[model samples]
Target: MTAYEYKVVPAPAKGERARGIKGTEARFSHSLERVMNDMAADGWEYQRAETLPSDERSGLASTVTVWRNVLVFRRGKAGDVAAYQPRKLDAPKPYVLTTPLAEAVHDQQTATGTSDPDQPLAHPMNTLVALPVASTAPPETPRLGETPEVARTARVAATDNGVEETQDLHQMSSILRDRAARLIAAEQPGRS
Candidate 1:
């Protein structure tokens, strides 16, 4: 509703040194703080800082871009009070997801009344809560006239399948060791 004026100035490159400041980072921050305070004392509200490019002549006919840091400040204009009404922003719409993940969340919410996780209706003394994994993808059905394609998977015989081929991780290592031993023996001509 009110018009505004802006002021921009070059920011301090280094921090101001003080008796109590120990590190360069601390000193630099102190310097920046001082600049902000000085501007605020003059009734200027602190705004955002920006990096802008400036073009400068490099040689006889060449130009180069130099990045410059600046601090921005703003205040209500003293003279202009009736012009430039800023556009009002509309509120964002509520997010409604209909995916399987959202459906799973809804299912879990109904099961334990975990919709409000802070005060779960079913669980009271739980230190850690693990959310149920939702079905990531829906199964694809074959078209009316088209047959479903099948993948060829090797069927291992019960006799040929060793203990090393078991689902256990430790058992898999035994198979690797056995294969390594067989390879070493084959490489040696003298050892049958």
Candidate 2:
């Protein structure tokens, strides 16, 4: 499990006032661009912002309702071994051909004066089907002094039953790259 530290601050105003009106605070969305830029410098990420309702009794028969925005910021706690600990990924076992066709092919190849045991058999009725065998080696680990960008690109796309997937930050590159290419092409001179 991952742990996080949270900070709650008053949401910035989109209108006239800066800190919002006291007591009867109006509903306004905070400018997250500024907050995110500032927080990103300090290694904090903006998770989400929430607006809560605060009700106060103005009189015996009247209740005043006020909505205030609460900006939430979170950062992963540092030095948490569990968060950074590498998950064990067991490699897939290689599959050996155990079908009757395979055995027959082997026998036929032997009878035909073929000495190579690894040679593929070509039969009319019993066409030998070769299934791809997965490697039995363990998953590759990041070497010392390796950058995060390199490590991210080297991870295999598949996962096993008992292992959990690591957090990936570079999955959107393909989509973003296509969009960027289209944008660049559109800006080029003289395209009617």
Candidate 3:
């Protein structure tokens, strides 16, 4: 279980010149709601949320006055029978926005002057993948002695040099399996 702090800051009112912008408040509200929903989905129960009083002495216009609200989420403790108790949640890491993987790969390939004939080309930024809001639990690790059949197949394929077709098929299958595993691992819980 963990504790997380989520904040909702009201968008500062725009100047009269910019008052006609569409969807500004709606977008901000949706973003804040999504953050809260995501935390709830991750097994974090809402502990508390409150708005702090705004200071009028700061000379800012009342319409533009900012109200700060905070939401604290906490996971329940484990059962009492456990041998070792889990530690409290650590401070969250700073958020750094990143390009989606496909876009990043495309950018890298373009920078390096290499192009793949098999893949369709598109703008890298257009493929950005938004992350899910809630954090998931970690995946269980595989046992040490559990060797998958694909490993054996790969070994056999490596020794058969005379059969080009079989080797090619095996290599492609191995590549696909590896890629799938990588994607699954990336999506697994406790990744943050």
The candidate scoring highest on lDDT is 1
By lDDT, highest first, what's the ranking? 1, 2, 3
Across residues 14-75, which tens digit of lDDT does each residue of candidate 2 receive? 63335644332342323445666778799777878899999988979899998988778888
Q: Stretches of candidate 1 above 4 Å error? A: 80-192
- If candidate 1 were superposed on the true structure by all CA atoms, what would the RMSD be? 14.6
- Error at 61, model 3, angstroms: 24
Instruction: Order the numbered candidates by TM-score, best leading.
Output: 1, 2, 3
Q: What value of lDDT does candidate 1 attain over all alpha carbons?
A: 0.75
lDDT of 3 by residue, 70-147 (tens): 666675545533435566898999975465665666665687576894665455554465666765632244346655
Give the lowest summed-lDDT range of ten residues in model 2.
21-30
Candidate 3 overall lDDT versus native: 0.59
lDDT of 1 by residue, 76-182 (tens): 88777555556689999998755664665566667765676456445433323455678755335554654555211112232354556446464558779999999
Clashes of each: 1, 0, 0
Residue pairs in steric clash, candidate 3?
none
Question: Residue 30 in candidate 2 has what lDDT?
Answer: 37
Local error of candidate 1 at residue 6 (angstroms): 0.5
- Determine the backbone clash count of candidate 3: 0
Candidate 2 runs further than 4 Å off: 14-30, 51-68, 98-100, 112-192
Clash number for model 2?
0
